[model samples]
Target: MLKFTAEHEWLKLEDGVATVGITSHAAEQLGDLVFVELPEVGAELTKDGNAATVESVKAASDVYCPLDGEVAEINQAIVDDPSIVNSDPQGAGWFFKLKLKNASDANALLDEAAYKDLIA
Candidate 1:
């Protein structure tokens, strides 16, 4: 399932893990990315906590954790070439995999329609 936060983070959940990334809207707003810093594997993250950093030609922004979890894996591709985020923020640009503290907590987040309304 896919869920989104008001902060513009998106999560794709399967089993107990969520792949997290900045939304396309966020990527567009940030412009072309120049750098990305991801959390260490095994780091515990709280909902809404800063989980990663992305710097663009325009500005730098925090990629917030949309739910409480431990970092299971980090995507090093985006760090190696941050522009990948601009090209595919919701796909190849994903920042990390999180092992959710409570998988059910994802149900409380926004759905696609609500997130579109929020960004509207």
Candidate 2:
């Protein structure tokens, strides 16, 4: 399932893990990315906590943890080439995989229509 936070983070949950990234709207707002810093594998993250950093030509922004979890993996491709995030924020640009502390917590996040309205 896919869920989104008001902070503009998206989470795709499958099994007990979630792949997290900035939404395309967020990427557009940040302009072209120049740097990305991901959390370490096994790092514990709390809901709404800073999970990663993305710096663009316009500004730097934090990618928040939409749900509490432990970092299971980080995408190195985006770190090596931040522009990938600009091109595909929801796909190959995902920042990390998280082992959710409570998968049910995702239920409280926004759905596609709600998120679209939020950004609209």
Candidate 3:
């Protein structure tokens, strides 16, 4: 299972890390994005803080960090092709994965059901 932010960020848990990205709905809202600013690997991040950037044809938005930890990896392919965000926001569009400093951070986010309600 995954959690989501009201801001439309999705978080997937795997091996104690949270893989994070914008939702398909968010990509749809942003329209055609032109650029993406990915976090550097090994960068320490703060929960709910800025983690990355998405520059759409309409506007540029910051991707919020879903948990506190060091960024373990980032998807470079998506950086080269930002449209991957719109095409597969949940899978290949995932921006980065963070090695959680505190596993409890998951409790602070909205579960899938709650998130669906938020956008509904």
**lDDT values, one for every candidate:** 0.93, 0.93, 0.89
Mind giving the per-residue lDDT tens digits that candidate 1 earns over 1-120? 899999998899999999999899999999999999999999999987889988877678888888899999999999999999999999999999999999999999999999999999
Model 1 root-mean-square deviation: 0.7
lDDT, model 1:
0.93
TM-score versus the correct structure, for each prediction: 0.97, 0.97, 0.95
Clashing residue pairs for model 2: none
In candidate 3, stretches whose alpha carbon ends up further than 4 angstroms from where it belongs are none
RMSD of 2: 0.7
Alpha-carbon runs more than 4 Å astray in model 2: none
CA lDDT, candidate 3, residue 56: 81
| Residue 2 Cα positional deviation in candidate 3, in Å, after optimal superposition | 0.9
Candidate 1 at residue 10, lDDT? 89
- For each candidate, how many residue pairs have backbone atoms clashing (under 3 Å)? 0, 0, 0
**Model 1 pairs in collision:** none
Q: How accurate is candidate 2 locally (lDDT)?
A: 0.93
